[model samples]
Target: MLGIKEIEAIIPHRHPFLLIDCVEELEPGVRAVGYKCVTFHEDFFRGHFPQEPVMPGVLIIEALAQVGAVSILSVEENKGKVAYFGGINSAKFRRKVVPGDRLRLECEIIKQKGPVGIGRATATVDGKVAVTAELTFMIG
Candidate 1:
């Protein structure tokens, strides 16, 4: 398992932008499973909705990408590098993610060629899927 500090070492996100809290499982350059503890204090809640706050779908995808980043950047050769989003494909939001949700994020490297790769990513809440996407990234 990896915490925010370890995750910070692998990816270039911080504070409000760093969506993941802990990584429960990781296979360097292959796959990762992580968690995001949603809370009412999130800044987005103020504008996303005043009465009924919903975790934005784009942020869910970003959380999944961060997990994918951990999987790729943890590899020895990719250390100190950054993973940039090349594209997002087949992104779907199945349910609304709200405060107090513990989002489970998982990603697997489905394809790769040189510095570019594709990840099959998903985010779930209480075993129910909230979002899924195929993320393309480039290691820099």
Candidate 2:
């Protein structure tokens, strides 16, 4: 398991923008499983819907991408590198994520060619899928 500080070492995101809280499982370049503990204090919730406070779908995808980044960027050759979004495909949102939800993010590298790769990513809350996407990333 990786704490916030360890995750910060692997990725350049910081508070407010760093969507993932910690990584629970990692396989270097192969896969990663992470979590995000949503709370009413999240900045996005202030404007996303002051009344309902649903977590934005895009942020959920970003969190999943961060988990994917942790997996790919942990490899020795890729350490200190950054992963940029090359594309997002087949994305689907099945449920609304809100405050108090513990989001589980999973990503597996499905294809790779040099510094570019595709990951199959998913975000779930309480074992129910909230979003899934095929993310293309370019390492730099």
- What's the CA RMSD of model 1 in angstroms? 0.5
Instruction: Report the lDDT tens digits of candidate 1 across residue range 66-118.
Output: 99999999999999999999999999999999999999999999999999999
> How displaced is residue 19 in candidate 1, in Å?
0.5
In order, candidate lDDTs are 0.96, 0.97
Which regions of candidate 2 are displaced past 4 Å? none
Give per-model TM-scores: 0.99, 0.99
Question: Residue pairs in steric clash, candidate 2?
Answer: none
Tens digit of per-residue lDDT, candidate 2, span 41-130: 999988999989999999999999999999999999999999999999999999999999999999999999999999999999989999
Task: Report the C-alpha displacement of residue 122, candidate 2, in angstroms.
Answer: 0.8
Q: Model 2, residue 129: displacement in angstroms?
A: 0.6
